[model samples]
Target: MRFSLLLMVCALCSVSQAALTFILGAHENVCFGVFTDQPRTSISYYFAVQSGGAFDVDYTIKNPRGEVIVTEDKQRQGDFIINADIAGEYELCFSNSMSTYAEKVIDFEIKVENDKNDFKANMPDQPNAKPKAHIENMGKTVDKIDQKLDELLRAIQYYKTRNNRNQATVKSTESRIYYFSIFEVLLMVGMAGLQITVVQLFFKGSRKQLV
Candidate 1:
C-alpha cells in the first residue's frame, strides 16, 4: 500500500503547473527557470499584464543550450508551448524596459508535461490480470478528467486577466475625456471674455472720436 501511495505521489509531481503573480518595476527584467531531465517534453506558458504601461511587456524563452526558442515584444498577453530538445534548465524572461514610470502587474503560468508514450511503456506487463488492466484504464480516464479541469482553470484565469485590462482601459479613457471637456469649456469661456472686451474698447474709442 505504501508503495502504491508513493507511486501516486510521484505521478502527481510529474505533472507540474504553477500560477504566479509579480510586480515588475519600470525598466526591469525578470527571469524564471524550469528544469527537465528528458527531451521531447512539452513546456507551456501563459502570461498577461493586468495593469500599467499600456498593459504590455516583452518576453523571451531560451532553451537549455542558450538558444532562443521564442521572443515577443510589446505584448499584453500570450500563450505558448514548446518542445524541449535537450535535458537542462530553461529560462523564461519578462522585460518592462520600454516603460519609464509605470510598474506592471503580471500574471503568469508554467506547466511541464511528459510524453504519454513513455508513461504507457512504463506500465508493467499484465497479460493475465484483467482486473488490474481495468483499474489502469480507469486511472487513465481520471487523468484525462484532470487535464480537462486544468484547461478550465486556465480559461477562467485568462478571462479574469482580460477583464482587468478592460477595466483599466475604460478608467483611463474616462479620465482623459473628463480632462479634455474641462479644457474645452475653459477655452470657450476665455474666448468669449476676450471678444466682449474687444467690443467694449471699440465702442469707447468711437465715443471719444465723436466727442
Candidate 2:
C-alpha cells in the first residue's frame, strides 16, 4: 500500500504543482487556456474564493469550438472533472464583473490526466499474464486512495476559504463599531453643551426680569 501510494504521489506531483493563488480585481475577467494533444483526456478543475465581497465569482468553461461546457454565476467554489474528447484548447475563465469595487482572492487548480502511460497499457499481452491481476488490483487501490485524498484536500480548502471570509467580516464589524462609538460620543457631548447653554439663557432672562 505504501509503495502504491508513493507511486501515485510521484505520478501526480507535476500536475498538482500547477495550482495557483491570485487576486482577481473588480470588474475584471481572467481566462486560462489548457491544450490537450490527445482525445479522451481527463481534465479536472477546482477553484475557491478565499476572500472577497460575498466570497463568490462567475466562472465559465469553454471548449475549442467556443461551446460552453459549464457556466456558473456567484459560486463560492466548485470541483469538476470533464472529458475533453475533442483535441484542442479548453478555456477556463473567472469574472468579477458583478463586484463594482471589491476584489477577490482566488485559488484554483487545473489538471490534465492522460492515459498514455497507464499501467494496463504496459502489461504483457499473454493470455495468462501472472502479474496482471495483481497490478490491476494495486492500481485500483491506489486510485481509491487518490480520490479520498482529493476529497480531503477539497474540504480543507473549503474551510480555509470560509475562515478567511469570516475573519474579514469580523474585522469590518469591529471597525464599524469603533467608528460608531466615536460618533455617539461626539453627539452626546454636543447635546450636553446645548442643554447647558439653554439653561444658562433661561436663568439669565429670569434674573434680568427680577431686577
Candidate 3:
C-alpha cells in the first residue's frame, strides 16, 4: 500500500512537470516569447521600439476588448512575470497599433509556473547543454532529487486535505457568528422597548398621583 501511494504521488508530480509552455519569437533570433502552461489562459500584446533603443510593449489583458488594457514599455532580455487576479482566457500580443521594429538578436528565458500541482517541477533554461559534473555525481543527484520530489508530493497532498477541512470549519464558524450577531440585535431592541414602556408608565402614575 505504501509503495502504491508513493507511485501515485510520483505520477502526479511527473504530469505537473510535463505541462506545455508556450513561447513566440518574432524577427529571426530576437527570441521574444512569453511562457504560460495553462491552456485556459491567453494573452495579447503589442510591441514597439522607443527612442532610446529600448522596447515598448502594450498589452490588452485576458478577454481583450480589441483595445489596449495595460502597457509594458522598455523591456529587455529578462523575465516578465504575469500576476493574474482571475483565471480566464488571458492573452499577450506583440506589435499591434505600434511600429514593428526590433533590434539585433536577443535571448530570453521564460518560465511558466503553475500552482495547481503537487510536484515541484523544473524546466532548464538550456536543456541541450553538456552534462554537468561527472556521470557518477549526476546519477547521485538524480536519486536525491527523486527522493525530495516524492516527499514534496506527499506534502502537497497533506496540505490540500488540510485546506479543504479548514474551509469547512471557517464556514461553520462564520454562520455561528452571523446568528449570534442577529440575536444580539434582537436583544438590544427588546431592552429598548422595555425601557421606553417603563418610562411612560412611571410618568403616567406620577401624574395620576398629582391629580
Candidate 4:
C-alpha cells in the first residue's frame, strides 16, 4: 500500500505548463479549465490584455466545488499563485460584457508545480544508506535556480506587455495630433478669407456714398 501511494504521488508530480492567446468580443465571456488530482498542489497564472476596450477585462477563478477563489473587474494584467486544497477541475474565466464595441486580445499562462521531489526528501532513510546532506544541498540549489528562471520569465512577459501598450498609446496620440493640426490650419484659413471679404465690402459701400 505504501509503495502504491508513493507511485501515485510521483505520478502527480508531472508538471503542466501552457500559454494561451484569445480574442474576447464585446459583451462576451470565455472560460478555460485545469485539472489536478492531489490536494495542496501549487498553481500559478499570469495574464495581460494586449489590446481592446480600455485594455481591461473581468476575471474569475473557481475551485473544484465551484467556489470562487478569486474575482476581479477592470483588470489589465495580473499574476497569481494559489494552492488547491480540493483536487478536481478548476475553472478560469474572462468576461468582456461591460464593453459594447471594443474587442480584447488576451495573453495568459498557467503552470502547476509537482511536489514529488519534496516528498522523497522527507521520507525516512533506510539502514546503511549514505548521508543525504550533499544530495539535499544539491536539490536546494536546483530549486533556487528553477525559481530564478521563473522570475526571469515573468519579468520578460511583463516588459513585453508594457511595450505593446506603450506602442498602442503612442499611435493613438499621434493620430489625434495629426487630425487636430489639420483642423486648426483649416480654421485659420477660413477666418482669414472671411475677414478679407468683409473689408472689401466696407470699402465698396464707402466709395458709393462718396459718389
Runs in model 2 deviating more than 4 A are 1-17, 115-123, 126-129
Tens-digit per-residue lDDT, 99-119, candidate 3: 344332221122233442223
Clashes of each: 0, 0, 13, 0
Q: Kindly list the per-residue Cα lDDT of model 1 for residues 34-124, writing each as its tens digit.
A: 8777777788888888888788999998887899989989998988888876877788888999999999999988888777667766778
lDDT per residue (tens digit) for residues 59-98 in model 4: 9998879999999999999899988778777778889999
lDDT of each: 0.81, 0.80, 0.40, 0.82
Tell me the tens digit of each residue's lDDT in model 2 across 1-211.
0001011112333232258788999998888878776666778889999888898999999998999999999999998998888887888899999999999999988777766355346546887665767877887898899879988988888888879888999999999999999999999999999999999999999999999
Deviation of model 3 at 94, angstroms:
57
Error of 3 at 49 (Å): 56
lDDT ranking, high to low: 4, 1, 2, 3
85 Cα displacement, candidate 3 (Å): 53
lDDT of 3: 0.40
Q: Which has the higher TM-score value, candidate number 3 or candidate number 4?
A: 4
TM-score of candidate 2 relative to the true fold: 0.83
RMSD each, Å: 6.2, 6.8, 19.8, 6.2
- Candidate 2, residue 95: CA error in Å? 1.1
> Which run of 10 residues does model 1 get worst, by summed lDDT?
1-10
